[model samples]
Target: MSAEQLPALVVVAPLVAAPVALLARRALPAWMVATAACGFSFVAALALAVQVTSGGAVSYALGSWPPPWGIEYRVDVLSAFVLVLVSGVATVVAPFAWASASAELERERLYLFYALYCLCVAGLLGMTATGDAFNLFVFMEIASLSSYVLIALGRDRRALLSAYQYLVLGTIGATFYVIGIGLLYLMTGTLNMADMAARLSDISSTRPVLAALAFITVGVSLKLALFPLHLWLPNAYTYAPSAVTAFLAATGTKVSVYVLLRFYFGVFGTRIVLEELPMSQILLALSVVAIVTASLVALWQADLKRLLAYSSIAQIGYITLGISMASREGLTAAVVHLFNHGITKGALFLLVGGVALRAGHAGFDRLQGLARTMPLTSLGIVIAGLSLIGTPGTAGFVSKWYLVLGAIEAGRWWLAAFIVATSLIAVAYIWRFVEAAYLAPLGGATPRAGEAPAAMLVPAWILVAASVWFGFDTSYSVQGAARAAALLLQ
Candidate 1:
């Protein structure tokens, strides 16, 4: 295959490797297959990122068929950015699965875990890379199905309930998305996004087009876990195996957000979605409520994992709020926050997992005395938590800063105040963890256990270190986000 074809290959490699992983079964051979597939996929994503930065945009028609007639795999700066996030997390999480799988999943099902992971990763990659509307739905299903399986494999019996709930809600979301695609296809007779965009420019004011936009917006909002529709997120994240939580926290909703951006900006165009309709107002209202309500709920969670799950819903609100502002600065805030928050939450969840591995649980009551025993891991958690609060000189600060700027640019001083107020709410929840970990005495009265294995600690540190590293390095995120925002505007 040519170098230009690597985007398709990057997605296909894991897809092709999944069956190999399944064939390897639960033996050490299965681990080898996972490592190989994840490793190769990681490299392919890096290569695609490099190629996109150097070459502008990359597009490959499936089976040598041209656009509007055949499926296309396309990579631009934004898609490449998400590809890196998805594949990179999968690569790091694989080694983590080695230690974590036995603790939380059936030994015989370990190979199946990696196999489904690869499928999920491939589906996300496919969703981000495809230029066809129908293909996006197909890939969305691939990812969502694998996600349900991954959630169901958690050690806790409650994970089954969580998985079933997510399955039902996620299936409804995907079906809605498909129906929307069907509406678009019926109206335009073409599945290609660029071709649809060209055709949509001609008759976007029509009733069919407006209905199609409404269907797609609601569908994507559900998929992305927007407020009032995010009931499935907390239980799913809280009960899922630690490795699954880390991977999904870093990638799943982010990909859904990318799909939202792709459809809103790339397919339907800005004027129709932002100006003609009341989407921005609806998004703004929900985002504000999500930020306030979710953060408040996070404060009350007794379980650390559940707390973080609620925090994720709040963080998603920040991302969507930026979108609601509909300015270049606002979109930049959203895009940069997507990457920044991923690293922060990934680090935090990994630390939570490590805590679970050593202490046998991750409840705040269970984690007392950890600060003395698992010093480094606890510190990592603290650092990530600080970032979550948008503490100065962290990655989270940069995104939140841009968001505040966007609010000011939109001349909404109320939004700026609300942003700060919600951050104070964040401080409350983060302090709840900090106080429990550092100040509270041991609840069990037993001596603290040793740290988690090096496999888990190292990966957690990598993400934590990245959170700190990216805070000071604005050139990469700033330029990339700006380019992506500009591209969306165009």
Candidate 2:
């Protein structure tokens, strides 16, 4: 395909495959279709990233119509980087879903699961790639609605409640986002992001524009699970099927964060939002609370999945903390942590699926002596956990290093100290699992079980290996993040 066609193909491929998977009506065939579609999308995303990085931004107008009159898909350094991350995680998680879904879902419902999974992937890609504000909202709903169905497919009855809760909150968030976009449209007479950015500069200080910014920030914060608005996340993730949890945890919130970045820096510019308004201070304060409070809450959780869910909030705080600084190093830290945390949490959640398969649950009591029973899976979790704690020579440490440097560059010594202090909280929770798996002996009366099959183990370890590999070789993530940061600030 030509470079111009690449952006549309990235979204269209998986979107077309969703209906095909649903029509297949057979579990294996549906899974094959979904996996192949995701793989194709990942390749397209990588191609788009390379093209944009080498050739500058790529914009494609639909039906040969140009921007401000026709819908356009734009790919810059930031959007291209996010496209690769979302598609890459979806591709890695697709094969592993087969084994995990077979175990959790009924045979009749397996095809439906694959169908929704494809739609979710397509929606995330579309949201990242679109240049129109209305188009972004459309894609956001497509992903969110599919996610509700996927979460409700869990074996547990509470999955229904979690899905319902997410549905209600998600709708509110989408509504707020639409309202903000509507206001922007009234002010600028355009829905294209680039056009909106150009027009917003003329009236950015007006009351309507400031109100639009407020609505958008609150709406995106709820969607991204930013601190106090994060009530929907833990239960939703905890009750969803393991594969669903892993996929959503890795890509869903990250896309929302991407939206925040696109609007805050790309459309509105940093000066108005970060300086004229109180967004930076508000985000910084909430991020600190999320890091400290969520980590403490995670330390007391009995269920392993729920523990990781809480830890996800803390990690997201780290990402937003970097963004709140509004400096070059700060934005780079945010982008790098977004990728690193996605892989680290994805690896951890995938391993939790293994624990759920063999132990029948992921509670700490059930995980005793798992090191002896599921050695490879346990090892993967340990390595991922170390990354979470920001141990040196791990992917997590690289992001933290940049974050601290950003803090220091801003002359916020107290913020730098707070970052280190919260990392210790991560250490406390990680050690909880380590102690349970290694020191606590298995009870003799417990049922016998072995390691998860190769399908699940392989994908989980691929991410685990990536955590170490990216840690030692930071060229792709660090350099891409720096370039993306510079482009955003320009």
Q: Which is the leading candidate under TM-score?
A: 2
Candidate 1: give the clashing pairs.
none
lDDT (10s digit) by residue, model 2, range 397-479? 99999999999999999999999988999998999888888888985522257889899999999999999888999999999
Candidate 1 positional error at 157, Å:
1.3
Compared with the true structure, model 1 gives a TM-score of 0.98
Give all TM-scores, in the order shown.
0.98, 0.99
Per-residue error (Å), model 1, residue 85: 0.9
C-alpha lDDT values of all predictions:
0.89, 0.93
Worst 10 residues of 2 by lDDT: 442-451
> What value does the lDDT take at residue 92 in candidate 2?
91
Give the clashing residue pairs of candidate 2, or none. none
| Clash totals in order | 0, 0
Off by over 4 Å in 1: 445-447
